[model samples]
Target: MVDFEKEAIIENLSKVINTKLTEKANKFVTADVREFGFIGDGLVSDTAAVQKALDYCESLGGGEVIFPKKQKVKLSKAGYRSIWTWNTKTKLNRAYALLIPSNVTVNFNECELIANNEGADVINLIENKNASVDLTKDSNIEIKNVTINQSIDIDTFAYNSMDSCAVCFQNIDGLVLDNVKVLNTYGYGMRIIKASNIEFRNKIQIDKCLGCNIRLGWQTFIVDKVNINLLVCSDSSNRLTANAVQGNTLHMNACSDFVIKEFRQTTSNPNKYVGSVNINNNCSNVYLGKVYSIDTGFKIQDYSSDGSNQPYNIVIEDMYTEGILDRPLFYIMGEGTKINNLRCKNIGHFWINNGKYTQFGRAILEKSSFVVKGNLPKEVHFDKLYLYNSSAAFQSNGGQDVVTIKDLTIKWDETTNTGSYLKLLDIQCKFMNIGSIVHKLEGSMKDGGNQKGGILSCSTENTLTKIGNIIDQNGVKTENVVVTLSTGMSTMINLAASNIWRDSWLNVLDVELVPVDLTSSIVIYNSFIADTNGQSLKINHSKAKGMEQFRLIVKGYKHIKE
Candidate 1:
């Protein structure tokens, strides 16, 4: 405490050299034109000085070039024009930050990197034609904690094409970007082309960008722990365009084996006129998790020429979709695609159309296959299923395909002018089980003229072995449930359980059943027929055997009325 002179000397040493040492350890490089032998800041305007600094650092075996703090370094006209043209034949070997010796970080704080004039692109990395940034040459290349602020003040009438990022990452690999924000860019956020093994962590915010958020071209990139908020909040009608117009948040074209996790995106008013995610052109082995969307969710299509064995092995799980009035939750039109554990709410339509003739929404494969479930607006002709909700639960247009449906529930609002409780057309499954409870139907049969009700119309050569009961309060009186069994061969229609209601009329109207054929050997047994008012059980028009063995137990009913 008494050594005042020693304390003053130590304080002076720390104030001069120790502080500079601490700043250097923090990786903050400040620019000094005087130290670099420049006449002034204006003379060193171009990237020539910057490139020379990088080259000098590399020539010194490996170091960092510092920029002066709180300095407004303007790029010369030649510098702005030449920034995109630096090393057009190969990637910049400067390696701003490498991984071997822990790399280097060139921090730009209170220092700006600006284009000389308006409407000029700030950075460009072209491939083959120009020099490319090859990150594959090294294991780890990191770009983090930096701010790229570009000016957008330009003439409205002047056709000056100002793009902040002309081309980003052409054929680069093993690159990492964290906490890197781009402000006021005209082009894409990061256009990755043919580069693989990349990871982007932390916050990547693109403010006032007039292009797609990000684009990946046939590359396997792992993106984890990232939060993106693109506020396309512009008053100009034309400015509010699609987030990812041509591609997806992460689009893969002919690429495979990629895992994308915990990816989130939100906008104030999404350009609802466009689709959010699009998976196209033979992209397979994709695993998606926790992908939430405000508008139309995700669409996958297999547009292969032969349409066989293309876009195979796709798995999507735990996805939530919410849209406005007229938007679908998920639209799938491809072969050999499996979706499981998908929860969707507040959607307009849900569809799964067949990409092939044989695979017309077919979801099962002869007891040795997967099961299809969940609510769908259109027909789902799957192999094995447990489905629920909407007017028609399951509709199979493809005849002679084996299908089984369990726990089927159908709901329709009478206020809406839609038709049918369930329509099963041209189905020939080995065994059919239908459990339907119609909550609402459009027009009641008591109002007559149009007999609107559930129907099971079959147009095939096989038999429908089992038919389940219908639980309705009005007792099948809403409309006549039609079950049409096609003719030519001996077919058996077995009513396993019957819960026919008090006012219900179970009409089994047969087609192509001739008198002699009916007398031969057709069997319809174990069926309860309850008719108190003598309503006829019309079994007409069929050419088959064994009709005498068709035992109908009539209980609590009067005689048939002509």
Candidate 2:
């Protein structure tokens, strides 16, 4: 019941369609250097000829530019030394290396743009003096599978002697770089300035560069799957002062909504590398993940000097650091910067210098926050915090907006010989929440060693509320531990507690503690007290109520007969 003539016609039409598709695929252009008047062997430095081939492909509306396998295309001085000075009008023709106009696609696979000189650079993209590429007012550009072996000394180029940036993209949109590797650059590896919707991919190694690895300026950029390797070395014998690498491994300035992932920095020297990553100067909407520093850590500062509505909406999570020295894992000077999840081990110091504007900043240290304070902030917030071998864990001078200390673990190693565990002076924060504590104080009393212990402070105009368990595993007697609460010009001092200990000294003066103000009550149940000389709970100006429920159990105590 089939139409045999119709079936034969359909079969013949299918064969003809298949033949035409094959012909189109075979006719597609594949650029080779030899086809474009490249006569010498592949080892010869024929970058001009190679660029000419690339330009021809671009003129024909974009295609793949292929290189011979296992062969090198050495870039000569004429090809690599081209510099586009800023503020000057320059015309790049199709005769050069594929002048990528707006909305053009240039793909390079199995090709290598190697440096002619063993130590020289391979590609140079200079910004004109007018601060724009002047790409005939075009925006869409894309590049892939390209390798740029940057020059080691870019100062020799007079046009771009001031700031040598390897790959500079300005005033462009929808630019994508994938599977690209840039090595041995004298200046910054890659710079994306004033660009929008830019995406770059894996293996960005800025090894032994004179400047920072990357710089982001005034652009909403998102960097995904980034692996940054910054190795900066210096020899003292050569009278070389190891200048701390200026700029950050990844620096953000005046930009917004920036997300960086898998950021890692490995350096041999600590002092030489300053600030693994810096977020400052009114940059907002930032997200960081898996930030690891092998030898040197990071510093996050807020530079809102003009008071331009301090940067907000910042999150740093899953941070792992090791072998750090004289640097803080997290430093927040901006307002409302939150650190949710962190894991740090074998670090030198962690500091939060809120500068003069201490009343507006907020920091949440969770999962073990440790530090030794050379200079402290006026106010701070700590939750689930831990300290080890650190001289002073909580040190603040007062005038804080808020201070919350919860679930603290302090361990004094035998190596640390100076300062106490906690120190607070003239604090004027609105609320102070302290809960759950374990203090292990160990030292010899031979040479003024036991003079320093835990929770040594002078405070005023703040609430002192304590709840939950307190365990003291110290070898010596717990003495000289004082908590003084007084009032400043403004707010009254409030104190409330339940089931608390008196093993340390507690002095409350010039304050009021009411039940209504203590709705979120501090409940302490079944505790022990072992104060040797100091009073357990000293109430001077006892105007307010709420301290009648504390039960103190004392053991092995010899009180001096008054």
Candidate 3:
């Protein structure tokens, strides 16, 4: 009877605890904007009511600020108040319509926001307390399922602040922007600066932003640890004709440890834009997966304010490009960049500037080519590259320490060939090594063209070697001369006069003498052979029959200094 009484007391205490927990869970309330005097009609301005709803939600220890489903919120103008600054040094004044607080989730519920031709950001993550900005003040904020549209009356929209964008996230930690779409923005679509531990997920699309589609970081602070799933920047109808100069799809500066997957930048007309992707300043440890660029080029430069930073440790996988006829596909000025599997069409170039340890793997160019210009890299390597009907496979300048090309194939067909010859390789370097070169030619392919069937032309100061029977045509040491020979005549020819034997040690292999004048009798026994005495070649005919002219051909191989 005493054990049964103890069990009844414990069960009675559990019921009281469960009743109090349910009351605490009910306190976590979601604030709707419609209850705070928000009208869902598209004609009325709902900026003031939306701001009030966000402020009230944060006062209740941070909850969801939800909008009416499929509502149209119009933000006509911005109030003149400096709540946030762009950076510490510049301290550019910026105004925002909505400022998100800490530990809050603004869920738009697939609603659309329309902004007028005003110079203001639709949303800013940080709320500057005074005239200063702090990098670690706020945390844990998210904005999802919002579509922003900015309407510009071209003549009235003045270019004001640099941070005027659809959405701005600066100096915040633990942030997320998911399922965001921006269209026809006056400035940039999304401006992210000096933020850490950020994520942009579930497909972000920016269409025809006047400035860069997405701007990340700058010269002051470094953005760290960002992951983006998929982003598509496109101008489908070529309507962005009035942009100033910043038309790049994505621009990143001074970023580190970023992994971006499946980014595509395409336009209907290429002449309307400048470039697609620009990763400038001191970005490092960045890996891009599967990028498709149509009618644009990729650039990585060091255009910092002080010009002291350079990017490194960058890798790109599976890139395809087309319709780039004005510039090269890639103009890189950084180090330790490796691109794997590049497929390109149309016509363009590929250049590297003062880079080190750059490599390319498995590239196929159809009606296109690759040329390296500017200050060459320190070390560059290529493996398994195929060029089909390309004008020139390699036209490289500058001097590299070590350049290796393995399994290079050049193909030409009758349907695409313009009856013009192709230049295989022309390079000047310190050390060059080639594994093999195979030509697949069909239908009216000539063994000897305007270049006289010369496939390789290279000049190296140190060492040059080609595997198998590939010979350097610029270093071939063969010369044929005609000299009139009397009974006992001796002539000295300067070996240095010939360009092929200028700095090379001549080793004579074979000598042939053919009589140019057939009417004169010739004596082979009395004819003297030609020999070199380390400086010049000496030829003598001791007992010839008459003054018969004979042609002398000397064939040998050249040996350069080690």
Candidate 4:
């Protein structure tokens, strides 16, 4: 191994670059489309002529092939078998601007190609796999300043999930497309599969795309290092009237290390039931900077059945939604796709739809607002759920265990006008709510000692500090929690006679148990209620046997035997 001086190396490298540039300038010649009998009339078939020019430029070891401005290089409408074909090696599709061969730059400045008639992508990239080993740095394909309009549909590939688009790239490393506008695409605007280091920048806009706007990684490819900045996902007059396209307007499947800086969804095209931003199938290391949408919010889900494919290590910093979504604006489904580790900040609006969030690792939600559409999921768990000023009307479905919340805020939804499910903190500590504050114990608390009833049986499994701390950390206590029971049942927090021999501390100062639409009662442990204003604790509604005497003095309120 020999060390070279830095200055000497730079000088030699400069010399080499100058030589290469000089050689390329002399050898890489450019050709106009008209040089090969090309007629600009839209009626004539300019496929052969265009193909000749491109092949000629490529044969000269890669060069620029410029087309006349605003020329209608339309496909021959008469006696045509296929408008475009996958010309991977033999110059890519013989027609249209589909496959961009290696070391070639086609500038369609102010030019447009009317494609998407037959499920063939307007500009598709099928990399020369036989090139070099490393596709990341070895590939070279750039398409700039072009406008692609794909309006045709192939009946054969109509329902194919990953078929037809404005531009599709497959395993093409080192590809850069700038200032590209995709319009009137029947299917997706663009799709890249098994590719690496592919970038589409400088205001890439997609309009009137019937299907998905942008898609990455299909069935069996792991896409990496993709960046799409200044993206716009819009449709014209809700073109997806027949439900041909579904899921997210922008879909990311099994992709990694990608960033979508700014996405603007101008018009709200619900397409009835499609989500605006959908990321699923084990996508990792993704960051969405800012998103403004009126349609639907972002949904991160894993449709895999075996828990093998789920979203991991993802972040969405700032998101703003303009309209009130009946659905959850930001949601995470952990059915098959496990949420390993994720963090998102500043959500506009949200609601929980009652899904079993079976998370394997940790999840942190900070500075996000949870709009209480209704009740959140029944069995939901988070390592740390920190709500700064979020309005969350949530409760435990008797299945929560050891949850920790740090400084949260709650409010009412002005839309529903129907007040929230108020009564909450109804958690189950291993079938025992030991020393817990019981607001709306479903059935009567089984005389306290009777473990067989619907009452929350006190368990001595935990210490006094732990139980007290857990109840204090409940989202309600810090900001005034009122547990309003649901109507239709007469419940109780029964402090039966059997509790006379045991020591179970109720971790509440003023437990307000009121029903939503009915009047229920809780028979306290005789000394349950002490005073009215200085408000001593009270346990006075229900009763059991062998309660002879009860004496208690708390907060200067004294009570005699009952």
lDDT top scorer:
3
By summed lDDT, the worst window of 10 consecutive residues in model 1 runs over 362-371
lDDT of 4 by residue, 1-562 (tens): 1121323323443454334323332245677878988776666656567667767877787877788888765643221212212222333221234345566666776676654233333333222322222244324566778777665432223443333455766665556777888766645677666666666668888776556777777545667766667788765332343655553467788787666677776444454433467777767666565666654566666676544565655544455554433333666643222333444344555544333333223433443455222122233334333333223334333333233232222222222211333222222232211122212222222133222222112233222222221222212333222332222222222222212111123443333333223123332433243232322233444442322222221211111112
Instruction: Assess the local accuracy of residue 423 in candidate 2 as a C-alpha lDDT between 0 and 100.
Output: 40
Q: Among these predicted structures, which one has the highest TM-score?
A: 3
Off by over 4 Å in 3: 1-28, 83-88, 118-132, 153-162, 236-245, 304-308, 324-328, 391-398, 414-422, 442-454, 459-465, 468-562
Candidate 3 lDDT for residue 260: 77
lDDT of 3 at 53: 78
Residue 188 of candidate 3: its Cα lDDT? 71
User: On TM-score, who's better, 1 or 2?
Assistant: 2
- Scored against the true structure, residue 503 in model 2 reaches a CA lDDT of 32
lDDT of 1 by residue, 79-182 (tens): 22222212345323211111111123344334545434424333432111122333332222345554554444311222223333422554433444556555
- Score each candidate by Cα lDDT: 0.37, 0.44, 0.61, 0.47
- State the displacement of the C-alpha of residue 479, model 4, in Å, after optimal TM-score superposition: 12
Q: Could you tell me which 10 consecutive residues in candidate 2 have the lowest summed lDDT?
A: 232-241
Write down the RMSD of all candidates, one decimal each. 15.6, 14.0, 14.4, 13.6
lDDT per residue (tens digit) for residues 193-298 in model 3: 7776676779888886666778888777567677778888875221343545366788899897777777898875566554468888888777777889887777
Q: In model 2, how large is the Cα lDDT of residue 143?
A: 58
Q: What's the lDDT of the predicted structure labeled candidate 3?
A: 0.61
